[model samples]
Target chain A: MVFGADRECEFLSAPRPSTQETFSGQPLACLEVLGRTMVERTVQQFFQADVEFVTLLAPVALSHSLPSFRERNRALKVKLANDMPLAIGRTLNEYSRNGIDNCFVVSGNLYAETDLLDFFFFHREAMRPVSRAVDHDGPLDMWVVDTAKAMRFDGDQFSKDVNSYLIGGYVRRLDHPADLRGLINDALVGRCAMRPSGREAKPGIWIDSGAGIDRRARIVSPAYIGRGSRVHEDALITRSSSIERNCRIDCGTVIEDSSILANTSVGIWLDLRHAIACGDKLFSLAHGVAVEISDPSLLQPMANVVHAAPARGNLEVIEIEEENLFPLSTQEEAPARPKWQLGANLIQG
Target chain B: MRESSPVIVMEVPTILNDVEGQAFLQETQPLLEGGRPCLVLDCSHLQRVDSAGIEVLLHCMEDAMKRDGDVKLAAVSPACAALLELMRVDRVFEIFQTAQEAVQSFHTPAAIDAPVTLPWYSHPGGLDALKAAS
Candidate 1:
């Protein structure tokens, strides 16, 4: 049994926009590395593990507002209540009554590339009543509990602490933006040691499955694009840039050393450098400032820009003749500068 | 024109092409010498820029400022923008939204528009003219 903490029926029933919205001036959703919504990606990982009979526990009032909560599999159960501690306890009690022996609980905002069910099974085989998924970062991302060890009188926090193991990805709990960056960089450099089975491809550039890169688009090495990111024609991505899932980078835009969160659409000809965009909040590394993008269509989601289209739209659909930004004559002249004359002469002479 | 008045613009290309830093500087140097106190560079067309390209821009900026001129950047591509920001050089120069803006800044009220002309590189024609006069 897998229990997702933020997916109750009540949260799903409420009317909310599909795009991200700021709740009380706070960023409500977490954006994962490679442009995926943290919650959506976490749920998908659970499905990938093939664990049936999942249950979502959410606040009854919040359940009515969250759209992801409304869509559920018939096999998955959902329970709603005010207090998270009580709600989880009651669900475990109910599941125990139904003779379910083991349960898996995970936070909705975690990004893990590991197989969760296998991890849980390993814990069970060890005869551990409570197993926590503790990752390299030394905090727990998930908790697996044998129903037999669950105490009836024990509170929610205590149950979580006793049963949860630190598991999944390079780090267990991502507390800050820098932690997320560290996780991605470590995963790319092969320091994390968590590659999905198969002939391991070196991580200079790891393009996930289902990602589409246009032939005309240029992707330099050492970049990681998450699943479902579409790189349009003539766009450039280079130098330690991580584009999260479901992001639309328009044509003629360049992304370098920037983290564009999931579901954000960067306009054409815009320059985003050293910036962290989480939903509607944009943080500039140089300025040490954060701005809230209130309008999704007009750069809400983060950052606003007003500019003409980079390319002319030919509605008649004439034959397209793409021009190279840098011609061959120009490219050959870069290293020919006299400053490196000695080095070039030594090699040639 | 004065050799010190070099205008540097860092270009990060989005498409893979053969344009080199020397060619880029060569194309822009003529405009910089034509009484343009501030050199404006548009990097919107660029995609990928190597470390050599960055060094070229820095050299140009240093040269231009040495002769009492300024190199301004405009419409920097996102990749190049990030690189400059990462190197902390984006703060070193005035970055404008468009080349027109950077150019127009030269005509601002604070500018004196002093006609301080410098000697140009000794071309064959100029050297021949000087020899004939002597």
Candidate 2:
């Protein structure tokens, strides 16, 4: 069995490597790279090792529930807890009571390809309470813990100076937003085992099901268009770029070496190069700056556009199609003080 | 009447939002309207620039172009440079590493009007050789 921590709020900033919230407010592990999230891919790796049951511990409830994988695995449990140490301790105690000898405790904030079966064998041979996985860089946030012996110990104390298992596999610490883009580029170029979750339509171009690409739109090699996303006419997606799920690339826009996150709408006639665009926020890796675009004509969240309805009465509906209209109708709330209110108070006085 | 300087260098504000963009445009209005104005915008202090700021830059360029003048950028920060490159504004504006370099560039002719040498094929017998080969 595998018990992983998908701590969305507990992100680490690099250079110092201390706990800090991501500037985008989205955790790196939870962000999708090549159509698959890092946490999801980590969970799948454990399942491939013939693990019977898997439990995910998150600080807060996930906005979207993970796939249960009922047919592929025995059971999948997602639990919420504020205290990670206590949660891991309690879970290990439960596992030990159920007669489970050992369990893998993986920090889902990292993408590691360390062979779990090999790690398990190493842990068994060493006869230690825990075995921490290490690479050339140093110890990763992955450990194989002995549930019975570690039942009394918290998650932090369990892995302290434990048996170190050296791994020569791919490992990426998903700490910064730039690392997320790097992961996407690495996966596209075959530097890592992580591949795009879509079918390779051409030599290097991958297109998922339900993606609509106009005939005039050009997708050069090593690019991906995700499911339910639309590429408008004359749009150019090239140079290891990925347009994730349900995104819209408007006409004449060129995406070069960039990752457009899920549920984003890039406006017409724009050139996005070496950047990561999530919703209306665009982070340029080359310039090392993140900008929040206010104009819907340039970039905006797809959620806002998808749910927007035309205003009633002589507002003169700008666009007949719901998708074309700017995402402003829904954003404006009812005025706190109506113009008629002040006039009525004056008349009453 | 005061003689207009051959080249004008203007420093951009740190933050070029909507209000600042309007003020910047108003400041450059005279230089843009002056005949054949060569302006260099110093972007060394520019930290953030929004769409309104971009529009102001474009408007300044448009006015200069109408008056047979040009506007160039100098010492652009990476953030502002990326924003310009994203919007493809870099294609239109000539960017320089320093304001002095941008100012110096105005003195040097970008292109020569007259050809220095004739093509070898332009010789009298060159056409005869071409006709025979054809």
TM-scores for all predictions: 0.49, 0.77
Query: Per-residue lDDT of B1-134 in model 1, one digit per residue for the tens?
Result: 33433344444344322357777667656655544345766778866655456666776677667656788888975555655554456878788888777777755634233223312234455766656755
Instruction: Name the regions of candidate 2 deviating beyond 4 angstroms.
Output: A1-23, A61-74, A152-159, A304-349, B1-5, B13-20, B44-48, B97-101, B107-134
Q: Is the docking of candidate 2 incorrect, acceptable, medium or high quality?
A: medium
Worst 10 residues of 2 chain A by lDDT: A6-15
Worst 10 residues of 1 chain A by lDDT: A6-15
Candidate that would win on lDDT: 2
lDDT of 2 by residue, B83-105 (tens): 89878899999999999999998
Q: Give the TM-score of candidate 2.
A: 0.77
Give the i-RMS of model 1 in Å. 10.7
Interface RMSD of 2: 1.6
Q: Write the per-residue lDDT of candidate 1 for residues A217-329, one digit (tens) a residue.
A: 66665566654556776677776677765567767677766676655676554556667665555555545445554434323342322111222221111111233211321
The TM-score leader among the candidates is 2
What value does DockQ give for candidate 2? 0.52
